[model samples]
Each structure stands twice: as structure tokens, then as C-alpha cells.
Target: MSILATEIWENRFFNGQWAVAEKNYAVTEVATGDQLGVMGYAQPSDVEYSAQQAKVAQEKWWALSYQERAQIFENAIQVAIDHKADIIEWLIKESGSIVMKASFETDLAIQALKNAMILPSSVQGSVLPTQNGKLSLAKRLPLGVVGVISPFNFPLYLAIRAVAPALALGNAVVLKPDERTAVCSGFVIARIFELAGLPKGLLHVLPGGAEVGEALVNDPNIASIQFTGSTEVGRIIGAGAGRTLKKVSLELGGKNSLLILDDADIELASQNIAWGVFLHSGQICMTSGKILIHQSIFEKVKQRVVEKVQQLKMGNPMDPSVNIGPLINQRQCQRVEGLVQSAITAGAKLEVGGKANGVFFEPTVLSQVTQDNPIFEQEIFGPVAVLMPFATDEEAIALANMGDYGLSAGIITSNVSHGMQVAQSLKVGLLHINDQTVNDEILNPFGGFGASGNGTRIGGPANVDEFTQWQWMTIQAQAPNYPF
Candidate 1:
């Protein structure tokens, strides 16, 4: 049976096997608001049951040899490759992703899966120097069952970033994807793993609302939590998980900046700015919320950006020519609309586009934006670009740093050395020189600082730290002797 079929609701993966839910939630296409299908709604008791099953299954999964575990991810990668077309289709329909964005996201998901194949062997332990007749060592072990709660934007890549690594590192996972993107974020993953020959009970997918998320966080059987969403919700999850002393990794929101210095190639800088502010309709957490340009070339850069923004066609994601698609939903569209209007009302000039037809908000660019403007520091997670001018490099850095979010930032300049120095001054976690902020590689430590995240880095070696706990062990040929 095809996982994307409407009948999938009756076979949603839960605990060890496919099970039907007593209740269901309708999933809809973001672009059209048409019903795609329904998914099982997990109650608190269902979350508890899933966690218990994951706990039991984790031990069995851990017993597999590293090679054995790696093979499963290899198979899963192949499975994903085979289903690439279906994956892209669902991403377009289910997540309002244009062809270009959906293709990029699908490729990233496959790359993330390929990266996980190495994690089982990449983790290393350390030997500590010990006194005579004693040997000591430290080893990393999986954190029993990991609870993953992912959001709607970049649903596939964000969810896989945590899920693949956690499972490859020997921990079971109970995933709670946002109800809005259940098919692409949760069911597609579940289907891929199932076809890859992953042992039953190791992975459970539960798509539901806030109550289910709260249940996952508060469940005792869940040893750690990996979450990717807004800062507001991240704070709530962090606080709730802290009470149980459970480890939590929160990849939250961002109000990133793209700094265009005087020496930067205008063509290159303008291109990067357009991509940073408008890619995925600027819905990415790493999206450039502010475009800071040097006073000498601010107008030139702004004009170029506006030209690019104006050329972008917004419509149904299924159309290959469409560069931008609808915002995730009406609620999100209204939130973006409010922010753009508030900025304009606060003396910011609307440069090119500032209109909305339902969920299809025009790609907007604003200039003469002051710090007091609500959009200046807030994450306008839409295709709206706020422009600011600065006289000196120090002033540019200061302007970029004037936000509570320290997630991602980019600096475009011919002077590489100067760009490096300026980048270092910004408090953001990820930095790009001569590139846009919306960049990610499986090897990079993909996370943010401060309100963006709680100092939890994902990807590459960071996964070992996020998904496992360290244990210190001592050994002797016989019993240890103590002065008693």
C-alpha cells in the first residue's frame, strides 16, 4: 500500500506495528487547503505506550553490531532514493514547497541519511591515564529512547537530522511531527525505515497536536528530547523537560542577518540577499531576517534585491515555474501580514512587494527600517526583506547583533580577512562568508545560540554528544586494592 494514499491513516506506525487510532486528524495541502488525508491522533496514553515500547526495543537494537546497524541506514538511503519522486510530490503538496525548494529539501534528506550510515562507527571512546594496577576508560552509550518533536517548516530535513543520527547511534525514537506535515515529516520516514528492514518497535510515529507533544516531553520513559520549532515553544519544552532531568536539544527560531559590505561584489551580494530572504518564502529558521548594507551601496543593493524579488512568481507549488509558494497556512500568512504592515506603519518604506492574496503573500522588501520597527529584530518568517544601512564595519556588526536571536548570519565581502573578523563579532552560531545564511551541510554543526537554541549542536560529531551519555569505567586484572 502506498503511504501517501488516504488509507494510510488506518495503518499509521505506532509502538511495534501499524495500528489504527481511535481518533484522527485531517491533513491538508498548504497551497490549496484541500484535504490530503487523515492521520492517527495520539492521546497522552498513546504517547506513553509508544515510549514504553521504544524503551524495550532500544536494548535489542543496541545489541546489533555496528556493521549490522549501518547496513540498515544504507538500505534506507536506497529506499529513499527509489522514492524520490513521491517524496518530492508530497513535499510540494503537503508542505507548500516549490519545485526548487522541494528538490533541495529532498536531496538534503537523502544526504542526512547517508551521513547517518557512518555514525555507528564514527563514535569513539577515550582511555584515561591511570595509576599502576588500574586501567580506566570512558565510553559513550545511547540515551535509551529519544523523543523527537519537529515543526512544519523544512519538515523532512529537520526531522531526519535528529531521527537518523539517534537511531544509528543505538537509541530508539518516538517521533511527534507537527500535525500539519504528518505525511512528509512522519509517515514518509516511517515507511522508509519499515521498507529498509529496521526492526519493529525501534521507531514510532505519532502525529497530533500540543497535548501529544506535552505528553512526549513529560513521559518518563523518554530519556532525551530533540525538538525543532519556534523559540516560544522551545522555552516551554525546555522547561518541561528540565523538570524530569531529561536531556533536551532545541533547534529554535532565528532572526538572522545578511551583511553586505562596501567591497562586496554587488551582483553576488544581491543574489545572496535574494536567496537568503526569499528562499522557501523565507520560512527557514536560518532565513535572513535583516539585510544590512554599507551606506555607500545600500540603494544599489536594495534596488537589485527588489528586482529579484519582483521577478519571483508565487502560486501553487506543483507548478515548476513558481519560485515562491504559499505560506504554510492562513494563521502563518496572517502573522506575516501583520509583521509587514506593522513595519510599514512604523516608517519603513515598502520597496517592491507588500500584498497578500490569501496565503500567497507577495515577496516584500522594506528599507529605511529603524531599530524601533517591529520587523527589524523579529523573525519575519516570510518572504519579506528588511534593509538597514550602516556606515562602518563596527556599526554593521552592531546592527546585526541587535537581536535576541543568534542563530545564523552571513557576510559578503571581497576582503575575506575583514569578513572573518566581522563574522566573529556576531553572536550567531552559524556563519557564512560570501554566501547566504540559508546553508547547511551534514558535516557542519547545524544549530544556533541563545534564543535560537539551548546550545545544542546537531550534525557530524555533535550527534555523538546529543544522542549519547558518557560513562567512566575502571578495570584491574583482579580485585582492586584499597587502603582499608
Candidate 2:
């Protein structure tokens, strides 16, 4: 759909069915985004058949009670967990991610699905107490068909985040997964849905790129669109969906920051920073973008961080010992390298990584970076981190909040009041005190404010609200004492 962005997946669903997929994407390199795969599209009959499946399934899918819907999600979670090893392998080959990343992302997906299984309670909305015989009731009802568009990074996790909820709400979904990671995630998740005994077509997976995505998002059958990826593309899809007045949930890009206070633990800070910055090549929206250190511990923190980063093993992701992997493709490596070079050109010091040799770039760090640097303002969806020293808490807060993207930020301080202050002051959706900003619990609700995108994907009672819309049903009694 997006030129040369294609994946080859075996069609298990259509083996005995009426239609079959001819190709996955536009045909391109698996990791580097170089054109390599065959430029093929699904047969027209396949697309039409899939849509018809969704259309027909929506009726039965929507008719299920909340617990019945949730049961399917719970079973899907079990299926995902049971197939973790196989899915991890697929993630490595298809998504260009480290095994550790695959494990975590898989875990995130399983948790989300598990959470989606217990949301009948979330669907219940309390009635506003009123006098007389007049009655007012509020409840959450499913959107008939949800169109889910997921990005390449954290493919399984993001898709599960979107799909689990839509299913839990008794809504059928048409998922358009990113081409690169389609096979491992799309195939695995779809299988989970089937094993869960979910009604067919309720969780249909369309393993194609932008063209397939455009078809689903534009279709009248799709009642909502939930997306995660770049801000530029997110805006385009979000705007287009808005024209149709479709309910949209988007988790775009972010330039998150992590601050180290003068009285913080350097050891803990450095270890956490290494995990937050280098893991996944920094290809996470919630990953720490800026490292703001207090002047007292600035040099100490820098030395420790550099030492830790240098020790990280950068190699093929299939190796269990490798801590870091290549950027999604050569193009992403180039983009991140360009940003580092630009920062150095702007007088920032490239303390660690400033150049790229191939698809792999060193887990890099840039020091003395200013607010004006593009590296600070833009989301570097690569393993690049910028570090700066702050004179005071006020300066730290100012530096941390300088970016247009406010997704998540972390502060390494044990002080409760200081932690609360920073959390309240910053404009981010999630804040972690004495921990990495990327922390997520299955019980927690995950979303962002500002440019990082709207709405959230997580497993919890609150997340069920995202899957359904609130409706107010009023009934008038025969004799009413309250004004009607």
C-alpha cells in the first residue's frame, strides 16, 4: 500500500474459505524498508469476502453479553501466552526487534487481553440520583465495528491493545497491521481469537499496509479508528476519519524526558536510563527522549550512563545476550544518524554515537543539547538520547517541558513532594518518580496528552470505557413527581 511495504504470510484462514490474500504489502525489505518483497494486493474477492464477514459477524458479535465478550478476550490472552516462544521468533525476523523487546511487548499484549476479559463492570455507568418517578440510566454500549490501525513498533502490543478492547465491548474489528510485523503478530493474534472461540470475523486481521488500511478506515462498516504511530501520518488518518465522524483514538509520537536530581541514586538512575533509552533502539513513543540532570550529579550521572551504554551488546536480535538491535531499517538508521549529526553541527556534543555503519547504529547519546535542537523538539524513533544539565528544579521542569510532545517523563528522586510537584507540573500523560518513564502495569490506564496523541490502550476497568460509548436511557413513569 505504501510503496514496497509488503509482507508474505501464509493464508490459514482462507485455506478452505472462498477468498485468499495474494500479497501482504507493496513488497519491500523486511527490516530496512528497502524495496524487496513482491508488490501484490489481496484479491478483490478476498477483500470483499473479509468485509462481508465483518458485516455479518457484527450482528452476532454485538449481540453477546459483556461477560461472554470478555471471555473470548481472556481465552485469547491464554493462547497468546501459550505461543510466546513462537511469536518471539516471528517478532525478531519480521519486526527487527531484540528478543527482550519481543518478550516485553508480548507480555504487554497478553496483559491487555487479560484485562479486556473482565470489563462487564466497566460497562456499568451509575445513575444520577433524582427525585420522583422519572428514571435515568447511563450505560456503555459497543460500537458496531472498530477499525484498528497499528504501527510497526510494538506491533503485537499495539494491535492487541486496540483489538482486545473492541472485542471485549462486543464489537467486531477490522485490523490493519503494519506490513513488516504482520506475520508474527497478526497471525498469532488472529489464531488466539479463533482459539478463544470468538465469533469469526469479530476479530478479523487484514495483513496489509496503507492501502488495505485506507479501505477499512474509509469503509462505512467501520464505526471507529484506533491508531498508533508517527504524528505526521497519524494526523492524516485522524483527520480523514474525522470527516466521517468516526470515533478515533490515536497514540502518536513523543519526546519524553527523564530528570536526575542532585540527591538521586546514580547507579539506579544509570541502569534505568540504559533500559529506557537503548532498548528497542529507542523506537518507543514513551521512551525517554531527554536526560536532564542536576548540576551536582551531572558529571557523575554522565560517566555512569556512558559506561553502562558502552557495555550494551549490539548484535542480531535473535541472540539472547544482545541488548540492542538494528533500527527497523536502514532508512531509520539514517534518520537517527542525521539527527545526531545535526545536533553536533548545532554545537551539541555527540558523546557516544554520531555515525552509522549499516542498519545498526550504536546506542547513542548527545550531550550539551539545547532546546532549539530538532533532536529535542522532534521524536527520534531510534536509539538516540540527548543529555543536558539543570541548575535548579525550576530549570529542570522548564527543560523537561520544552518539547511539543508530552507523552511520558521520569524523575529519579525519592522525595514524595518533589515527585508530586514534577508530576503535576509536567504536561505529560504518565509520570514516574524514581523509575523509567516507560513503566506500565496491566492494571494501569495508558494514554497521552498533547501531541503524543489522544485516548489510551491498556487493560483495566477504565480501558473498557474506550471500547464502548456512554448512552443515557430515560424512562417516564406513569406518575412523575420530578419535572420531566
Candidate 3:
């Protein structure tokens, strides 16, 4: 039986139990507008209570042996695998993800859990040398409680990236998944951990609106905040967390680029561009926002990309044949439509798609897009690709660096050394050579620069730094004789 069919699907997980809240939010299927069920809607007071309980739970959790804590994650990996079908269904229905994308997200979440299994053993303290006759050491300790705010796009993967590490490092987590994807993003995770025998009160799942998020950021009991969403919301969270001097990590928006150099394979470059721009309807943060092609083969690359875009299928994601799915909601559809219309009005040629039917938007391709066009400057989180021409490598680099966001960029060329030189000049935090912009690995450091993030990296070794604090300790055989 699916977990959603049981009582576990109806309530929030907090205070070590699944409890119904005073308010509830309807969970609807984004593709079909069908109501799946309702989830507990957290108020500010609920957030406050969760934070208080999380702090209490963290103390006991941190005292456990590393092996004991690691067992829970090992169990979680199996539990997640056992329920993979239900998880993928929830993602496809609740988050508007295609079947392939949902499966990929589920795999990523499981991979994150697998990676976290090593964290308990990987955390090591260093012995330091001191001038005085004393034993000195630097140790990493958990940050009591971590507050996570995940977005609707890649909810499962984004939430697990932080939640798994924070818990593996002996910290309690209070997660606020976007209300729209509460089932797959928040409730499903709680269910997995609960089945895996995680100690009570160590993880809290709260789904709500801005009020809940603000309370999570402001709660005194929360030691740190991890957020992944739009740059606009990230700025607010950063400011609010700053007032209280809390550690915060923001993986915000991205206006990523894909550069097709003069020496590139046109077919391979075009294939990557289509995949990067249209995957998950381009809802990914690292989705290619700009496509810079060398002027010598600009038209050839554009023709290939347009042909690929026109072939993509957009509709309900439950069907395996559908490559593109609906936007998360009506607001997002309108927002994308508005951007496309505005760009078209601004003299950007809409080569293929500029139409929308209900929530499903066609794969769009635009040429002659100049910097002055809104589509060129903005991070359009839609299946829209804007193509621009560049004269030289320097011009291509300048075009890639034009936006405020410096998240991720990709370069494709037969000349590997030339691609490396261009990659170095780009301002993005993550760069790929001979690959597309939207890429991730469990062991790689995932983050961005400038408006894309606040200089915090997540994944692999970076998790040890993000989820723990460093403390220096000194000890001596006897109290050193000091002048009284």
C-alpha cells in the first residue's frame, strides 16, 4: 500500500509524532489540478514549538555513538528504496515533475542519504601545535538545530541535500518545504526517517507560507538556516538571519549560460542545449538561461536547437512519452508567459514556441535576443532558450558574465585547453567543459557565486563545514603556574 493511502499522508511530523494542525493546506496535483489531500499548515507558534523541541532533541542525539547514528541513515536508504514508487508518484503529482525527472530526483535523494552515511566517520578533529607546553586541538561540533527552507522545484533533492547532512552530523532539523510540495518534499522524508527508527523529535516537517518561513528564520532556538529558492526570497532570509547572527546558507537563483565555441561539435552542442534548457520544463536553478554561439556557426546551431525544441512533447508527466510537464502552478505559468510576451515585444524573435495552454507551456526558442531584452537579463524559470551571437572568446566570456547571477556555466568545444581558458575567465561558481549547465553529483561541491548564493558550498566535504562549527580546546597535565 502507498504511504499516501495511509494516515501518514494527512499530518505534519513534529515533536516525535504525526499531528494535525489547526490549519490545513490543500495538496493538489499540479498537472491536472486535482486535490490529492491536505497537509498540516504550520503557524508561527507551531514553528516556535518545533524549534524548542528540536533543541532539546539535539542534545540527546549528539551524545549517541557515531555508529548508532549512522545506522539510522543506513536504514533510511533501504526504506527510501523500498518506497521509491510512491515517492516518485508524489513528486510527479505534487511537484509537476515528469516521470524521468522524478526518478532522477528520487535517486539523488537516496544518493545523498548514502553519502551522509560516511559523514559520522568522516568528521575528524585536528591536533594543533602550540608554543607553550600544552595539548591543543580543533574539533567540529554540531550546530544544535538547523532550519531548512526548500523550494518547490526540486524539492526532494534540495531538501535532502541539507537535511541528510545536518542529521548525520548530530543536529536536529526543522524543515519548511514549500507548501505546494509538502507531500513529496516534507512528509515523505519524515515518513522514511520514522520508519528507519530515527529518535523522536529529531526531525520536524512544517509546511506553510511566508509566516512559517519567517518564524523559522527568527526563532532563537534555530542555530542555522539553509535555504534554496529564488534570490528575492533568499535576500529576505539572509537579512532576517543576519539580525540574530545565525549561520545561513543560501543557494539562490541562477542565470546560467552555455557557450558553443567556434570549434564545437554543432550537433552535440545543440543536443546539450535542448536538454539543459527544457529538462523539468526548465524549472531547475542551473537551467541554461543564455546560449552564446560563435558568430561563424550561429545560424547552424540555432537551426539544430530549434528542430530539437519543436520535437519535445509537453503534457501530463505521468505519461512516459511526455518530455515537458506543467509549471508548478497558475502563477508560474502566467509569470513565464509574461516574460516571453515581453521579450517578443522587445524585438526578440520567437523562433518556435510562444504559446501556453493551461499549465503546460510549449518549448520556446528565441533568437536575436540582445542584452536589452528582459529575457536576456532575467532568470526565466521556464522552457525558454535565448540565443545570442558572439564574435570572439573574449566577447563570449563577457556575454556569459553579463548577469548579476554567477551560478553555473558550460562550454563545449573540441579544443579542451581553449575551453579551460574560457571556463577560468567565467565568474560562475560551477563550470563544466564539454557539458551542459544543469548537472550535479553527490560528491561535488554544489553552490554559486554573487547573487546566486552567499558563498556557502554544500555536498561532500563542504557539508562538514556547513553543518558543524569549529572549536579550539587546550589541555595541560597540570594547571600552569601563573602570576597571582
> Which regions of candidate 2 are displaced past 4 Å?
1-18, 24-52, 65-67, 120-123, 455-459, 476-484
Question: 1-484 in candidate 1: lDDT tens per residue?
Answer: 4545666555354556778888888878888989877778888988999999899999999999999999999999999998999999999999999999889899999999999999898846898999888889999899999999998889999898899999999999999998888889888899889889999999999988899999998999999999999999999999999999999999999999999999999889999998888888999999988899999999899888888987888899999999899998888888888888999899999888888788888999999999888888888889999899999999988888887899999999999998998988999999999898998888898899889999999998799999999999999899956999
Inter-residue clash pairs, candidate 1:
none
Clashes per prediction?
0, 5, 0
Which residue pairs overlap in candidate 2's backbone?
Answer: 6-25, 28-36, 28-37, 32-329, 281-383
Write candidate 3's Cα lDDT for 78-136 as tens digits.
99999999999999999999999999999999999999988888846799999677999
TM-score of each: 0.98, 0.89, 0.98
Least accurate 10 contiguous residues by lDDT in model 3: 6-15
On lDDT, the leading prediction is 3
Better candidate number, 2 or 3, judged by lDDT: 3
Q: lDDT winner between 1 and 3, please give it.
A: 3
In lDDT terms, how accurate is model 2?
0.74
Winning candidate number (TM-score): 3
RMSD of 1: 1.3
lDDT scores in order: 0.90, 0.74, 0.92
